[model samples]
Target: MLLCWRDVLLPEGEHVTEKVVRSSTMMRVVIVEDEGITRKWIKKKIEDLGMGFVVEGVFSNGSQALEYMNSHDTDVVFTDIQMPVMDGLELLEQIQAMEKQPYKVILSAYDEFCYARRAMKLGAQEFVLKPEITEESLRSILEEARKFQDQRNTLDQERLKSEGESWEASMRQLIRRAGDPDDIELIRQLEEQGIFLSFPDMILVDIFFDGVIRKKLALELLNLFLEQEQTKGTAFSCSEQEFVIFYAYEDHENSLKQVQKLRKVLKSHMGVEVYLGVSRRKQDCGWGKMYRQASMACENRRFFSIPGCQSYESMRITAEGNPSEFCFFQNIKQIGVFLGQRQYTEAQIAVERLLEAVGEAVYLYPAYVKTMCNEFLVLYLHEIWKYDLTEEEKGGTGAVELLFEQAASHFHLLKEDVLKAVSYMTQLLKRKSGINGCSAPVQEIIKYIEEHYAERISLAQISDSIYLSQSYASTLFKKETGKKFSSYLQEVRLEKSCEMLLDSRISIQEIAVRTGFFDAAHFSRVFKEWYGLSPAEYRKRIILQKGNRIIQ
Candidate 1:
């Protein structure tokens, strides 16, 4: 009954011919031969196959085999073509129709090759003629079937992995806009594509950046940080300068340790200042709200001059929720009006009132306090521009970053900067108006100077226009306007130059020519003499200042 498979050897160095099957994988088998002797022999052969094959049943007809398989599972079904009741083909169909189809092998005589081919087309794994059936042939067939199943399992695993990745991506999106019905619907659709997510109570950690970092690099670092803490967390980019991490609420102590690890890694490895705002654990549709709380907490950390974690719950008690009680917006608007009117004293008084109101409203949220300060500074800058102040008098708006930092330690520094702007504008206004009450001829001279200051002019030219001698015209112009002819014209041209510097992005060289300077270097020299800053410096200072001055 056995054929020698001399070339085959098992992993244990046993001869493949010594056993009908050599694999460790136990394959349940059934026999459906109509001949009693052949069915008995097949069953005995499977039994002799040793470890891998188990002869589950021996049937005289395909009907009995199918009936046996109805309740019991078989890994491989071997059926003879000729049967009394249901033929092997019908039995193969019924077996293949089962929820889990077994590996089918058809047993046929040499003359039943056509039947074997038909059975193979019906999802049978192999066909073995009765005369050629051998230990080697049956074992090879079973080995081939095992390989196929292994490959299928691998493919299934790969598919599962791909689905897991898709699920994670969808979860990130869902968490970002959590509580939104549309996003929740999107999550359901994503589940159809692969895996499903049920959100547990979670905490949001918002990381704010003080400097620039590439998004890809930041994400990688964040992942590494999570790995170091052995924490399972999800991170997504929030903005150009911020990122957010969401971790399931496991334990408060462990979560705090994760935050500390992240902060340390960001500082030691990335050389960056990071502030983390942690929100309390929230479940269901509160992810978006939790994000806002964490963001507010993180932003407020800047007020302490320290880089560390801030918890939203810690600050909730102090936030008054009524920002209007302080009248910050009203006093800020009044101060702007007074500055526009060149009422330095009145603007100072309004500023004092605003500060006093702020002091009294110490119960306000830290976010509101920072926002009020920024609005006040922006409004003051806008008003300074209205008074025709030079860029040097504006103290360069880039300094606002420093001022904000200082306000954390010394709030008075901001007040001093604002008052300095007020005084600078007032002094500039008084000097510009020294010729306000000049005589009619002097007024006429001033008017001509204003209209034609861009062009070449001299005291002689002015006196000729007025029908007076040059020497007498000079004395009269000085006595009435309190400025010599050349000094007055220089003042008018410099003032025009300052206006162009603040309001326009035109080239400095073109500005010099338009402002009646012979060349850029000469114009810069005169500008530096008057404003204590070169033309380039003045433009940079004002541009920086204006950029930071957002309307409240």
Candidate 2:
């Protein structure tokens, strides 16, 4: 009655083990035996054991079984030794080398005790003789394997959970670092990372949320505005109470227009009242300037201002101004203080009053007003150019007159620049208007020319791409952009040729071809006209300048 394994086996004369049993909870198992009849018999016996065990697969040879085991998730493997190719011993060795080896039971007909001992040494879970293949023996081995699988599964889940927690913690740390402090050093670091930060005339908007979760929502809304498709060169920061946004653009009026669009989006989406103040751009502008502007814009929002935004320009300058008598310096300082303190409403009121006074002055003293406005605009633009300078010339000269000259020429070539500026200002004042007024089609024409300047692209090709008649496109383009299409294209090509001349490594002929010129001789003629020097002379001058730097 002791139920010994050997006593349960059928006589040696029988080819198959005749044990009929079944289990409800099937434990996954793999049988790797070369003999088909023996493998089938063993599988049937395993299924007969009502202890809930299921055979997942049966491989005819040890090699095939090893390949299946390498890719599969099996609880137990029953393999026979002494096979023709890749014996169970070899398969056991391979399994032991795996990172997570399966529980293994060796099934053999040979009464080789030595083989059993070897299997045990190779980490085999159990060794069973073919004649002693009884349900009791099978049950013992499966129970042990299932226990091992459960432990491993628990460990795997714990490991995955830990990794998830660690990743989340790292993200939280990064967010904290970004929020720790707002200062010049931080802004400079961001700039070094290729985030543009320069605003000569900035309107700072401090958006505060009333509800507990509203602040977070407002911050998200502000960030979305900065990343809007139509808005470019925008930066922002979020703190507990406020979110500050800075807008930098080539044209101040255009920037304000974009901000107005953002204001409308926020009002429609969030249903929260947001205050804004505009600050004049400082000579030394960075995070400090941004903070100052936002503070001022917020302060200016208090004086019966609309729910959205206001600009410093709207506050100080009037269409009817005797420009000479306007106190530009005093108004600038007052607006600066309003922004610095986040007094947006006060700033708006002050700016509006100042603008009215300036408007009166403009009519009384038109010439003086023109001079003052030009001087202020130029000074503001020059400060911005300093931020755009290359790293090597951080502290180098920033000449306003030179930038003004460039702007004048640029405006002459692109007559729509002033119109675009005007349209942008109008859009800003009218919040509901979207940014569809700019001559985007003309801009597309300019962009295409710049990109294909190295190729021999023609006006006909560009006109077709922009969907305009060639003659009409040429005439309209010239009228809107000030320069003839052909002239602009030529200027772009010549500018590229001049840059190539500085390289010295490129031959004149190669430069000519690269810059879309027909031949080197023709290229030389255009180069001389543009720069008053041949390609070789330009190269010589660049080399001399480099040599002087090295000597110094």
Candidate 3:
């Protein structure tokens, strides 16, 4: 018998085989043999040897093996030499032609020695004879093949590591070159590489770390952020212990909101403290302005004194107005600052004080009170919207509703009454503002006119009610509401005239006195301007429309 062993077989197979096979750390294997009985025997032997190989796949013939290889991945392949149409040699050739080839072994009968030799030349890892195969021989061959696979894997891993380092270096170079450029050429490059970079605005985030480990943790946290598809425009670079990220968003305020969200993500995920800064640019401003604003925002992070976001908008002091009248504005500003600092309790107290102050101001200036209240309501709603309440918590009845109720009660403004009043005011302002060449003061004058329209009224009387100089109010009322004060009062009087006209029992002369018109002729002229008909003609048209509806 000519004894042929591809690699040295283990001499003490019974002693070391079980220990090696039972070990947790071992490579996986696949077996391809045409003979079902032989395949079963081989599988049994592999398991019995207690070697650590996990047989992930077993196929009957070479064609089936090839099909399996195409769809599945394995660490090692065990193939029969002389099976059917697509034999071990053809399968080996196919694997070698692939972009990433797997390790291979040949198992054949003694008569196939010549074929096995050819397989070796074609990069078959090792060959084993079937009939005389022993546990010892199998273990040694697998050991040698495992060693070769480890060496190849190490080389491949090193190549990948080198490529990753080069790619990271390229990203840093692109970021550095992007500085001071009129447009970001790197964005075009990234897009060409199938990465998107367009955003309505960009926010630069700089995270400073105290130690190397914390710095790496920060970078990892930012990597998690990039995984979100909505954050595609974001890019990051790390230098030593500092990580800089450029986050892109559609809105300027949205970028600031993202920074606030990032702080919570960092604290919860990484257990690391970080300071964030944001700056925004308009969509048309180009990348140059974006980079400058972001850089400035990052530089300002040092002044925050704690982990938080510093934005360009947060730094400026708003211009002050009358000290006593605008005291509530100052209080709201302080409340906003407290909210920015994450001091919810202090912020709520400030909001309460602002509500109280506005209440006093409204009592002192009842004529202009609605305007003041409307402005404060807008501010209060905006701040409430800014609170970090979840969607579910804010739905139906929640903190927002409670705060609104508090605001109404504090100002002694009835909810139903205020809503009705605001609706009327909004309609009057909408019409007045939409008219050609209307001034803001005209809406105020119109408001005054409506309140006193049922009383004895004149342009001078209406102007005095709202405390505007009569001539100024008169000119503004005409410009804004698109009608002279006298004409607007006449229209109001004529509309009331129509309501009385509908009564059928009331005389036209009595309607004139009731709606603030001087006499029936004056009411007729005004009603004619308003309805394009005299009062009697207007009453007849209404009567005809109503009678026809009743008949139908």
Better of 2 and 3 by TM-score: 3
Residues 354-404, candidate 3, lDDT per residue (tens digit)?
545544332122212333334434443444444333243244123223222
Better of 1 and 2 by lDDT: 1
- Runs in model 2 lying further than 4 Å from the true structure: 1-26, 158-552
The model with the greatest TM-score is 1
List the candidate 1 regions with Cα displacement exceeding 4 Å.
1-165, 180-202, 208-242, 248-261, 281-285, 292-324, 327-448, 459-481, 495-512, 518-552
**Model 1 TM-score?**
0.43
lDDT per model vs. reference:
0.65, 0.57, 0.57
Q: What is candidate 2's lDDT per residue for 1-552, written digit by digit as tens? A: 111122121211111235533332346788888766677787888888755677766776677677656544567899999885699999999888775667899988888889989999998978888899877777788788888877876886687577764432332223223322345445554455345444344444555432233555665776677666334333344434345555545565576666677767766776766556544455554444445444444533432333566554454322235643344656645654654454544654565565545543311222223333344333333333433233322221222222221212111121222222222222222211111222666666766765677787988988889898889888877877678888878876886676567667789999999988999999999889888998889889978976663333
Write model 1 residue lDDT over 1-552, tens digit each, in one string: 111223232222233346433243566777777665566677777677664677766776777677667645577788888777798898988887775577888888756667867887888888888888887776687777667666765775687577774544554445544544235655565456432345454667889777777778888888776666554556777556678876655676677766777788776766678888888654444555577677766755744435788777665312256632343555666776776676766776776677656544422344345455656566555544444333444444434423332222223334445554444444454543443567778877877776677788888888888898999888998887767889989987998788678655678898889878898998999999999999889888877765554210
Prediction-by-prediction clash tally: 1, 48, 4
Error of 3 at 122 (Å): 1.6
What's the lDDT of the predicted structure labeled candidate 2?
Answer: 0.57
Could you give the candidate ranking by TM-score, starting with the highest?
1, 3, 2
Candidate 1 whole-model C-alpha lDDT, 0 to 1: 0.65
